[model samples]
Target: MEAFVSTEDEPDEVVDAELVPGDSHLPVIRHQTPLVPDADPDAWLPPEAAQDVADGIAQATRDAYELHFTQFAKWCAMEGRRHLPAAGDSVTAYVSHLTRTPREKTGKPYSPSTLDSVIAAIRTVHRDRKLPVPETKGARQVVTGYRERLALAKDAASRPNKASPAKRDVLRRAVRTLDRTTLAGRRDAALMLLGHACATRGGELVHLDIESLTPDDEGRGFTARLYRRKLKKWQDVGVFYDEDEELCPVRATYDLIDALELEGHTTGPLFLRMDRWGYLAPPMQREGKTIGDPTGRMTAEAASDIVERAMARAGQPGRWRSHSLRRGFVNSAREAGVDIVDIGRHGGWADGSKALIGYIEEADAFSDSNPLAQINEAERRKRGAHDQH
Candidate 1:
């Protein structure tokens, strides 16, 4: 059977192509021919170019790019502008719109970091299609300048839009509010503590597997092998149980596991999803799998949602995110006089991590370690000695 493949530079045209079978229901495409321009519709796309388009991006990145592209397309449709091979002027205009308008779902403006992702998505589509990227130097300047201005305005208003890291007191308050009697409540409590102790990102926490954790020598804690997505590597993370069983992550995790009846399942996702009725999702039976097999996993975004709800219930003000736990751990450790190197290693950061250094500097700024404070203390002692003399 012949299938129609949409070609670039030909909005109303489609070419007959052969479909290849895929692992799932959707058929994989071989793209029998190259994506030639309209002037040479029959000419094949260069083999190297096609290969670059195929291999340059990972599946997850492609999915994200497509999602961002769709959002841009929707905005273009509303504004009656072309989206494909998007114009520089249109992209600048879109940036303006993004800054000026709030998103419908969250009723908030997109963060500068999110805006960068959207721009990267737009560039990816253009690169795939072999088109000139719409975000030219001028367009980039306009967007970046606008972001700076927006940040300044926010600072002036004393409403700087940034996630507040979960400090020790904040974590304690949140844990105290968690109703650990219920299965979901227990799971959430464990999640909050584990997130803080391991300093794992939301994505890493969601993707944890039973096999990834090994018991410590005393069996009071577990060593977790976490996959760091940014560094594209696995890291051994140590998570110890607190003396207070009520707030101990290891105990909470074990309790949740017992409640879910996940014994003997050492290869499935550690965290499972919850149903609307407040029950943990029941394990499913696959074709060749055992009955009551737990395979469902939580998502990073779900982790954020969980944190946000917990913070609200704990009476915490200001925006809090999943990253807050990680940040909180770093700052708390630094404030407690933990060495920066040790903190970095615990957080799965590379040696001499500039990011970790930044955290340490920020934490030290308010401490007695500050140069000005040390100078003031020395001056006070000198003045006291002179008076005694």
Candidate 2:
């Protein structure tokens, strides 16, 4: 279960004894004990160490950590480096690989910040294990900065990648044109509202259900109470207009509910999907993922897949993802001159959502995706060409 290295002092005979049974940190565990090193991720964590991690994190957090760990393990296997779980070097190399290598499909390299996340994932595991580790970029500011600089340099080497405004326009155009008459349109509209409403994370939108949503029966409008996954708590954001006007968060969704012959408490699902023929029967829920009934439920993963499928149905590009809706919402709101603070509150953002501030940052702020600014530079090139001629 262990792969070991020999030190010069050990004369090339040091066995991977400590790593075997993966309780490498265990203090002389007996062979009689039912030890399973394979079950333990990294074997670096003694049972005590894992117990400490268990104490430090919630069950869900631990589950997430394990999930990420599993993914990192799989990525390592794909790269023919399954020995990584056994050594810190493997972890570091894997982090470096994520930063240095480009994805095969997109051929796009990870951003500096994205690469930092990869490093963070590895360091988290080591920290949980209480293992001795080198001062790496993820955990240390200096190392992180260095890694970011390296990542940026690689990006430069690749080319100054210019994101085309045409890409954004194409998606927006499609969303604007989706059918609004059928039940499908209402569902799409509801999806659009969330995506464009706050540029909501796809995961947040999908997991949103009946119990959490509140609608005013007076037909004035409704309110949605979202259990925000990223923030680890619930935050309420209401979108409803007066008796005369129509400005509700899920107004389109409400219309869909009526069109589909659905009714319930404010606690019922806001959006229950119908079959291809527009059947209104609820789908079975994945148990424990939610409460009581297990039908007509939606999931973030499923939401994303649904969005993609819907986009394809709408004749939009495949790359028009759920996130495109969120970004579109943010972009459209900003363009309409809606203040950032107001935008944040509507989007269910917590106070000091500095991490999500980039959504409000104008394209000209970075000029990274501002084609208009980039286009002006071409005039200088043309002038230079004329002068030389």
Candidate 3:
């Protein structure tokens, strides 16, 4: 199959090249292959070219783009439309179809932001192929129109399923369901608590290593050092314990570590995948799990699955997502009158972010001091005063 390779000079030039396969888990372009060793040796990329490409985009972003591209390709195949260097009309039609068509599993149409991602993926793919994306004409207008329609129809019909906060009350109740005697239970319990206390994303949670944890001198809790991908740096965030050990992330984490027999070893992953028989792997067994350049990190998807199963067991079916842990921490903090800036800092949100504002809004919406409740309270007080008079 034909592919494009980046040259130091004339980067936009598309040349006929054979596709070299990479890790089956990742897309083809991510792998480094010999570029037919061009006639001009200087034209060849440095050995680090593949790493350069991978580093240009976040791994999560690359995965999302690949998924979107695959979806578009499948749709094109089904509809008999051109995918590579697709026409403006074709891109618009795909977006339109996504907006209108409900997914088979969820029975819900794609949100406006999701459609935007699909477009981004298309643009990225076209750029990679050294093809000009038809970014103009009716296509841009179609996207604009879809956004307008989405805004106007801001009812439940147009909106995606609303994410509910995993409040303290809900989480406290959920923690009870875990069979703490079992290794899986201890790991999951710790995972949930740490996820909440740290306000960590799935990727961050899964990437944690034993060494990433630093015990506080005060002995109150521990600091979890996480690599923030968006910021492209490492951040050490504090994870404090609750008064109740049952609900304490620090304690739970320690208990999990003890259960796994990884104490005093500041290496390997903090969390490990359980065996088929629901047992934690001994240190000896773990070596086989890391066959190929493994960071010993669990996949974000696995972390999400852990969250899903735990929440389901907690009787919170369809009411939460992987984001619930992070969102819950923010929501709970805000409800406790924590400053918005503090909440943002804790959750790794950028200052004055629209995303931060959305979380604050959701937290306020379900608050006891919400507008509707305040209005109802005022009306009741007024009626009582009038009756007494």
Candidate 4:
């Protein structure tokens, strides 16, 4: 495995270094890449060097930070910042861009917290790569300055969007109307219901298995045990709905089992793809089968595409994304007066506050105000009168 590192040293010129060439035991040369005189200094590091630095990081860390760094790299490429100067202000300018760039879809800029992650990703690369990423004063002070700018941006993004609970119910209704007959349809319905009912993520849905899910006894509700990827967390989710309830994930799964006429299936996929002849095929056909792959698992992307098609046919107006299921459930749970901590439990979130921070409480929760609240208020007034007597 050979690795090439590129950098810019002076205006109108470039520098390069050769390391880890094809043969593991060969010596390499380090060349200085000069910058063009007319070129502007990059915010911190050149794209090639940044890429090399990022690639050298461990796989787990890379997965965690890749999105942030990739977005930063994209911004740099767009801005034509191809090299790092020994000044911190250059980095600050990049930070300003992150804070100021309005999101095309949302028309809002990045928040302080989000910008913080993006900057931290870049800064970590610089520090690890031993780049001179400073222009203002000290490195720490430079980061602080960037943070202040991010804070300012955060303030701008803070204004909330107000939507009625009725609107959310409308969305929920749309989700419920999806055809639950096809394998894809059934899977989509279950996924959406689990997201809305049990509060699950797409990744979590991808990970579902018979081993991870089980029933209580002869005929009760099922328990979905989810392994959280983000926080390496785990949660036990219980699902049960009344016999007459529509849009019920639990009932949907029950109906699926009965439809398949599966008296008992302890193994294999809980969800499978339907064949052209309209037969449910297990995710993996037997190895000796005429047209089945040796691998038995369905990829997550396939799962998402199924949902996408389902939503399209269902005539749902808003985007029905994988996270929508999770977000919808969280939104409903919060509005239902489920405590923040319990909400975290149901959603497999490590921290309730941070989870709830992204979720806006739906307006409809207040529609049927708690009668207990009114009773408590009345009792409090009576107690106050007694005290006065």
In order, what lDDT does every prediction score? 0.75, 0.56, 0.75, 0.58
- Screening candidate 2 with a backbone cut-off below 3 angstroms (N, C-alpha, C), the clashing residue pairs are 137-143, 195-325, 196-329, 199-326, 210-267, 210-268, 210-269, 283-295, 283-296, 285-294
lDDT of 1 by residue, 71-163 (tens): 887787678777877898887777777877776788776666666667887877776665678855665676677678767787332233546
Determine which window of 10 residues in candidate 1 has minimal summed lDDT.
Answer: 1-10
Q: Candidate 2, residues 124-228: lDDT per residue as tens digits? A: 765544444444643345336545576666645233232211123444454456567776666766765654554567667766665555667785556666766
What local lDDT does model 4 show for residue 96? 65
- Residue range 123-168, candidate 3, lDDT tens digits: 8877765567766446556667777787797745446555556777
- Candidate 3 residue runs with Cα over 4 Å from true position: 1-47, 71-84, 97-108, 140-157, 161-163, 262-266, 281-296, 366-389
- Clash totals in order: 1, 10, 0, 18
Q: Considering TM-score, which of the candidate structures 1 and 4 is the better prediction for this target? A: 1
Residue-pair clash count for candidate 4: 18
Q: To one decimal, what is the Cα RMSD in angstroms of model 4 from the true structure?
A: 11.5
Off by over 4 Å in 2: 1-88, 97-114, 138-181, 216-220, 241-250, 260-267, 273-275, 279-293, 309-318, 363-389
Residue-pair clashes, model 1: 1
Candidate 4 positional error at 326, Å: 2.4
TM-score of 2: 0.58
